[model samples]
Target: MAIKLEKVVETFYQKLEEGKIMGKKCTKCGAVEFPPVYACNSCGCWDMEWVEISGKAKMHSIVMPAPLSTKPEYKNLGKYAYGEIELEEGSRFNGVVRGMTKKKRKEILAAGKLPVPCHAAIYQRDGYKTVVFDLDEE
Candidate 1:
């Protein structure tokens, strides 16, 4: 089966190509949804609006990818890990965070800094752009 790209997804990618991060904000409850959706997840409302995100976020948890489980497409990402990221606008989601190695992860965990500050970046893929996060400097 083929996956269909919804209008919201298409618009999101278009904005990424323009070097902007966009999200859907609920006009009713003032909740924002990153990775833009057509409806609001907070109040189950369909009254959503497109908003440019600040790309500021926090990584609450980190899980490194196993050596054998790494994908070829991500080989160019250097060191990365999956993490639960919370946007500054109050949206939470799991996303790939670049610049994280096992050693770095160990060091961070030892320091008891779980929810570290991170900022989003637009990564150029083979044919498209995507969002990734990098740990902020201490």
Candidate 2:
């Protein structure tokens, strides 16, 4: 029986509402897929199982949001930017990172910190919870 894609998404958000970050790990090749996919991106396997993520990740790259392109719904997320985030489980995805300013971005680049340590933060938006990254102070 094939699982519906919508069901996977529903389950992901449901788990988030319960304050547990979940990911699907492939039993065949041990690859964990963040955002909880029904199929594994690695090794082409559908044998995926739900696993809790550590909420730990690293920021690889940053891209500031363009003024005109910014969404009104995200206005509350002041000083945010898009970045390439690599989860501790080894999955890389583009995610919204909070607490980013132009000065901070410059400093991180000047200091040669390409992959700064960050942790996941669950943010409530509208009526649903979403995950975002905050740069770790340590």
* Best by the lDDT measure: 1
> Once model 2 is optimally superposed onto the true structure by TM-score, how far is the C-alpha of residue 16 displaced, in angstroms?
0.6
Q: Candidate 1, residues 82-127: lDDT per residue as tens digits?
A: 9999999999999999999999999999999999999999998899
Using all chains and alpha carbons, the TM-scores for the candidates as numbered come to 0.95, 0.95
Name the regions of candidate 2 deviating beyond 4 angstroms.
1-3
Worst 10 residues of 2 by lDDT: 1-10
lDDT of 2: 0.91
Per-residue accuracy of model 2 over 31-138 as CA lDDT, tens digit each: 999878888998989989999999899999989999999988788878899999999999999999999988899999999998999999888899899999999986
Provide the overall lDDT of each model, using Cα atoms, as 2-decimal numbers.
0.92, 0.91
Runs off by more than 4 Å, candidate 1: 1-5
Clashes of 1: 0
